[model samples]
Target: MAGKGFGRWTVHGDGRGLAPGAVVAPDERLSWPATIGIGAQHVVAMFGATFLVPLLTGFPPATTLFFSAIGTVLFLIITAGRVPSYLGSSFALIAPITAATASDGMSSALGGVVAVGALLAIVGLVVHFAGARWIDIVMPPIVTGAIVALIGLNLAPTAWTNVQAAPFTALVTIAAIVLITVLFRGILGRLSILLGVLVGYATAWIRDEVDTSKIGEAAWFGLPEFTTPTFEPALLGLFLPVVLVLVAENVGHVKSVSAMTGQNLDDVTGRALFADGLSTVLAGAGGGSGTTTYAENIGVMAATRVYSTAAYLVAAVVAFALSMSPKFGEVIATIPTGVLGGAATVLYGMIGTLGVRIWVQNRVDFSDPVNLNTAAIAIVIGIANYTWVIGETRFEGIALGSAAAIIIYHVMRQIARARGTSQEAASPASAPAGTELNRGEPQH
Candidate 1:
C-alpha cells in the first residue's frame, strides 16, 4: 500500500517499476532515466512556439530560455509540482509587445508585462479565496468544453500557414506522425511526434530547405540577452486586458489536463493562476517575453500519455541548458517550417478532439438549449478570429468566446430559471422520443 510521498499527492506503486496500464500521472513518475528523456521530448514539443515569439518580437532568446527555466521551477514549487505545464513565451502578448516596443522601447513594454503578472496574481488570490464552487458555477461542463475546444480551433490557421510553406514535406510529416501514433505501441507511440518531426527534418534536408549555414557560425555558449523592465505607467493601459485572455487560456489548459488524466485539478486552480502570474512577472522583469502555459506541451501530454511533473521539470532544465548554446537554438531553427506545421496540424486537432471528448465523457446534455447555444456560439467565435479594440485593450476571438460562453450560458440559465424552466428539462426538438443520446455521462 502507498501513502502520500510528496506534499499532497499519493505516490502510486513502487517508484521502481511501472506496471502495465499504470498511468504515469502528474504526481506519479517513471524512473529517473526515463523521466529525463521524456522531459527532453517535452522541450522538443514546446520548442517551436517558445522560441518563435522571441524571434518575432525582437526579444532576446536568452531571456526567454533563462526566465522560462526559472519560471518552470517557480511554478513547480507554487503548485506543489502537481500541474504538468511548461512555461514559455506567450504569443498572446505579441501585439502589445510590438506596439509598446515601437513607442516606449522594449524595457518599458516589459515593465507593463511585469505589471500584468501582479494583476494576474491578484486575480489568482481572488480565485483562491472564492473556491471552485462559484468558478464552476460560471464555467460548467459545457462552457469549459467550448472554451477548451476554441483554443484548439483558434490555432488552425497557424498550422495551415506553416504547412503551406512546404506542402509535400508537411504532408510527409503528418503521415509519419499518424502512422507512428496508430501503428506503434509503447514508447514508440509515445514518441511519434518526435519521430515525425525528425523524419520531416530529413525530408526537408533532402530538399535543401533547411539552412545549414548557421550551425557552424553560432557560438557554442553565450549568455541569453536580458532586458530590465523600466517602470512605465503608460504600458499598463496596453497589457492589462490581456490578463483576461491569459486567464481564459489557463483555465482551458488546466481543464484539458483534467480531462486527459481523469484528475480534478480544481483545488490547484488558484495556485496555478498564481504560478503562471508569478512566472510572467519574473520573466518580464528579467527581460524575457511574458511566459504562459504552453498548449504545445499539453498536446504532447495528450499524445504521449505522460503527465509527470518531474518530466516537465526535465524539459525545463533541458531548455535552460540549451539556452546557453546559440548553436543548439540555431539547430532548432533549421527544423523546417513544414515539419513544425505538420506536427501542429495533428497536435492542435487532437486538442480540439480532447475538448469534444470532455463533452462526451462528462455527458453534457446537448438537448439543453443552454448547452447548444454555448457550443454553437463558442465555436463560431473561436474560428472567426475577430478582434475588438477599446482604449488600448484588445479582446481577441478566444477571449471573446471564452467570455461569451460563460456569460451567455449563465445569463440564459438565469433567465430560464426566472421563467420557471427546470435545469433538467431538454428542448423538445433536440431530444425527440425521450432519447438523450447526445447527453454525456456525469463526471466523477
Candidate 2:
C-alpha cells in the first residue's frame, strides 16, 4: 500500500504463530514481503479460469489479464481497500460473447459487452440506494449454501479426471497440501497451500511434465493486443440479458465473502457490485470480455483465511506484470494438470462446503418443509448443471440453483401466507437478513 490515492497498508510484524487458515481481516496487514507472496498466490488462483475466457471467446488473453489487474486496483480505490476481492474475466458471459462474435465483427460485438457492464453498474446503484435487503430476500442461508455446495459438486468430474490422469503427482500434491495445513503453524501454516503447490510443481518437473517450450518461444516484452469497441445498438440489446447472470454470480460471491470474513458487508456490497460492472466496461472498451468477481480467488481466501486487501493489490501488480510477458505466462502454463487438479480438488471442495457451513451456522430451520425441500432439490439441480434458458437469457449452474432455491422458499412462504392459518411449514428462520452465523471464528 502506497501513495495518497490508495489507503495506507500497515505492515504487521506479528504475522506469525497462527494456524493454517488463520483469520486476517480486510483491515489487517502482513509484512510487505509476505504480502507479495500472498498476492502472487491470488493471481495463480485466478489464472486458470480468467485466461480460459479469452481462449473460448477469442478476446485477447493478455488484455483480460491487464484489465483484471487494473480493474483490481480500481476496485481497491473505489472500496477503499475494505473488500478483498479479485476482478477477472467472467465465465458467465462466455456464451454471450461467443454468440456475439459469430458474425465475425468483434469490435461491434464488444459494444454489446459494454452495455452489459452498464447494466451491472445499474444493479449496484440499485443495491446502494435500496440497501442490501434485496440480497437477503434473494439469497438466504439455505439458498446460498445450496448454490455454494453445487459449485464444488459440478466441478467434481473435472477434478476427478485431472487427478486420475496423473495419479501419482496428484496424490503427491494433495499430500503436501494436507500435511502442511495440518502440521505447520504461524506463517508456515498460513502459506501451506502455496508451499504445497511449489512442492507439487517440483514433483511435476521430476516427472518431466513441466514443458518449457512455450516459454522459450515467447518474447520478453510486449503489450497485449488491444482493440477499441464499436458501439452498436442492436447488439447492445442482445447482450443486456447477461446482466442477470452477472447479478447471480456476483451476489453469491459477495455473500460468500461476507460469510467467510464474518463481516456484515451489506454496505460495501454496492461498492463491490459497481466496481465489477465498471471493470467490465473498462475491459470491454479495450476489447476484453466483461469482468466479474472470481470465485477462484474466494476459494483461495477461504483456504488461506487471509483476506487482506494488500494481498489483492499484490495480485493485481503481479497480474499486470505477467500480462506484459508472454514468457512468464508460458512458465505459468508449465504448471501441470496434476498440480492444479489436486489443488483445485481441495479448494473447490472447500468452497462448496461453505454453503453447508452457512446452513449450520445460521441454524436454518431444516424441519420446515419449505426450507428442507428448497435446499434438497436445489442442490441436486445445481450439481447436475441445470439451466433455465429463456430467449437470449440463460441461467445455469450455481445461478440456476440460487434462483430456484430463492423462488421456492418464497413461494412456499406465500402459499403459507395465503392459507393464513398454517403450521404446514415450520417457523421461518430466526436470523435477521445478512446474518453472520458464527462470530470470531476463522472459516476453514
Off by over 4 Å in 2: 1-6, 16-22, 232-238, 388-394, 420-444
- The C-alpha local distance difference test score for the whole of candidate 2 amounts to 0.76
| RMSD, one per candidate, in order | 4.7, 3.8
Best by lDDT: 1
Candidate 2 local lDDT, 1-444, one digit each (tens):
212235575555476444444577777778777777778778777887788789889888988899999999988888777778899888777766776788647887677778888888988999888987777666777777776677667666667777887888889988998898778667666676788889999998999988787788899888998898887676665578667667766666766776777666667677788888899999989978788877778878877788888899889988898899988887887788888888878777887887787687666668777788888888887778787777655666766766678789888878967887346533222222333333533222
Q: What lDDT would each prediction earn against the true structure?
A: 0.79, 0.76
Give per-residue lDDT, candidate 2, residue 296: 73
Q: Model 1 misses residue 37 by how many Å?
A: 3.2
How do the residues 331-371 of candidate 1 rate in per-residue lDDT, one tens digit apiece?
88788999989999988888787778667766678888878
Name the lDDT value of residue 354 in candidate 2: 75
Residue 43 accuracy (lDDT) in model 1: 83
